[model samples]
Target: MELVFATHNRNKFKEIEAMLPDHISLLSLDDIGCTEDIAETADTIDGNAILKAEYVRHRYGYNCFADDTGLEVDALAGAPGVYSARYAGDQKDDKANVAKLLEQLKDKESRKAHFKTVIALNLKNNENLFTGICEGKIIEERRGEKGFGYDPVFVPNGYDRTFAEMEMKEKAEISHRGKAFKALIDYLSK
Candidate 1:
């Protein structure tokens, strides 16, 4: 089957594509002539994911899927929730965002947080959504050099190191995005 992954970020594309079946021909926004930007004004992961997916499906008249992820820190009362991408500012600098998070939790002893992801599947006849989350604690200092976004500071529940510290395959097997996409895959496979 053919799927249009509604995202402009190559990292997202790579991560999702890596988990899909070989029989599926997945295309990114760029490959499908969808270079225009869309505002992510939604308040939740499911809303954002569905909004993006529906937008792409309607714009191209094709079946498409989209995902939205959020890193919620309990110390901040789920701060940077839906605004995870642009938490720092509109420019969305990764370093600055991480700096802001680190500073916010500087004095807090409860370093608990979780990564959640919502995947929206927009089919011609129906729309379906899948969600997943990984429970983990936030580290004071960033570690490792792999993965992207807030990976360096997020260590999965059972692991001692952050996502960036693990190999791509290992990370893919346990990452929040991985868990979410795997659920989506399971749903599709059925």
Candidate 2:
């Protein structure tokens, strides 16, 4: 079966693609000629994922899935939750977002945070939602060269290093997106 993963990020596509079975073929937004940026105007992660998945299903007539992830900090009152991507600005600069988050938590004691990923799948005109969360704390500074978004400074619980410090396979085993995709893949296999 062929499915479109509604995203332009090659890193994200590659990550999920590696987890898929040989029977299933994955396609990106580019592969389907979907160059236009899908607007994520929803107030919540679930809503955003649904919006993107539905948009592609209706507009391009493809079986697709889209995911929205957020970094919610306990000290910030769950801030930067739905607005994680553009937290620093509309530019969606990862470095700027991390810097802003670090600055905001500079004086705070509780560094508790979690990464949440919601994946919405539109298949055969039916919709399904899957969610995964990785609980951790934001470190004082960036740590690794791998991974993207807030991975450099955000470390998963029970781990000394951040997501960026871990290899792709290691990070996927414990990442929010990884867990969510696991559910989605299981569903697809059935």
Candidate 3:
């Protein structure tokens, strides 16, 4: 089956594409000629995912899935949740976002945080939502050179290394996006 994954990020598209079964043909937003940025005006991660998915399904008439992820910090009162992408500014600078987050938690003792991913699938005129979460904490400084966004400083629970430290295959096995995509894959397989 042919399906579109509505996203402009090549990294995200590649990560999820690698996890799909051989029977499925996954197409990125670029492949589907969706060059315009779909506005993420929703107040929550799931909402944003839904918006993106619906946009493509309605405009491009393609069965597609879209995902939105956030880094919610306990000390920030769940802040930067829906605003994870543009946390530092409208430019969506990853380094700036991490720097700002670290500065905000400088005086706080609790560095608790969690990554949440919400995927919205529109297939055969039906909508499905899947969510996954990874509980972890933000380190004082960046660690590995892999991964993207806040992966450099965010460490998953029970692991000393951040997501950036792990290889693509390894990170996909335990990441929030990974878990959510796994559920999506299972549904598609059935």
Candidate 4:
């Protein structure tokens, strides 16, 4: 089956593409020639995910799927929830965002956090939402050199290394995005 993955970020596109099964043929937004930025004006992950998926499905008349992820820190009371991408500023610098998170967490004893992902799938006959979450804690400092976003500062439960410290395969096995995409894959398989 052919489907459009509604995202402009090639990193996300590549990661997700690697996770998909062999029977599925996935195309990125660029692959389909949808270069226009789909505005994510939603206040929540569910809304944002659906917004992107709907845009591609309706505009291009193709079965499409989109995802939105957030790093919610318990100490910050779920701050940077919907604003995870631009947590630091409009520039959306990952380093700056991590620095801000670390600064806010400095001197705080409670470092609990979690990564959540929501996927919205738009098919010819139906649309649905899938969600996945990985419970973890925020580390004092960044670590490793792989992965992206807040991977360096997140340590999933029962693991000694951050996502950035692990290989792509290892991270994919445990990531929130992985879980959500797995659900989507299962649904499609059935």
Candidate with the greatest lDDT versus the true structure: 2
TM-score of 2: 0.99
For candidate 4, list the clashing residue pairs, or say none.
Answer: none
RMSD of 3: 0.6
Candidate 4 segments whose C-alpha is farther than 4 A from its true place? none
| RMSD, one per candidate, in order | 0.9, 0.5, 0.6, 0.8
Q: Which ten residues in a row have the lowest lDDT in candidate 4?
A: 124-133
lDDT of 1: 0.88
Residues 20-138 of candidate 1 have per-residue lDDT tens digits of 89878898989989889877878888899999998998889778989999999999999788888888999978778888999999999988999999989999948998888999988
Error of 3 at 89 (Å): 0.9
TM-score of 3: 0.99
Q: Where is model 3 poorest over a 10-residue stretch in terms of lDDT? A: 10-19
Model 3, 60-177: lDDT tens digits are 9999999999999999999789999999999999999999999999999999999999999998679999999999999999999988999999999999999999999999999999
Q: Arrange candidates by lDDT, highest first: which order? A: 2, 3, 4, 1
CA lDDT of every candidate: 0.88, 0.97, 0.95, 0.93
lDDT score of residue 143 within candidate 2: 94
- What is the TM-score of each predicted model, taking all chains together? 0.97, 0.99, 0.99, 0.98
At residue 83, what lDDT does model 1 achieve? 88
Ranking by TM-score: 2, 3, 4, 1
Task: Compute the lDDT for candidate 3.
Answer: 0.95
Give the poorly placed runs of model 1, Cα more than 4 Å off. Answer: none
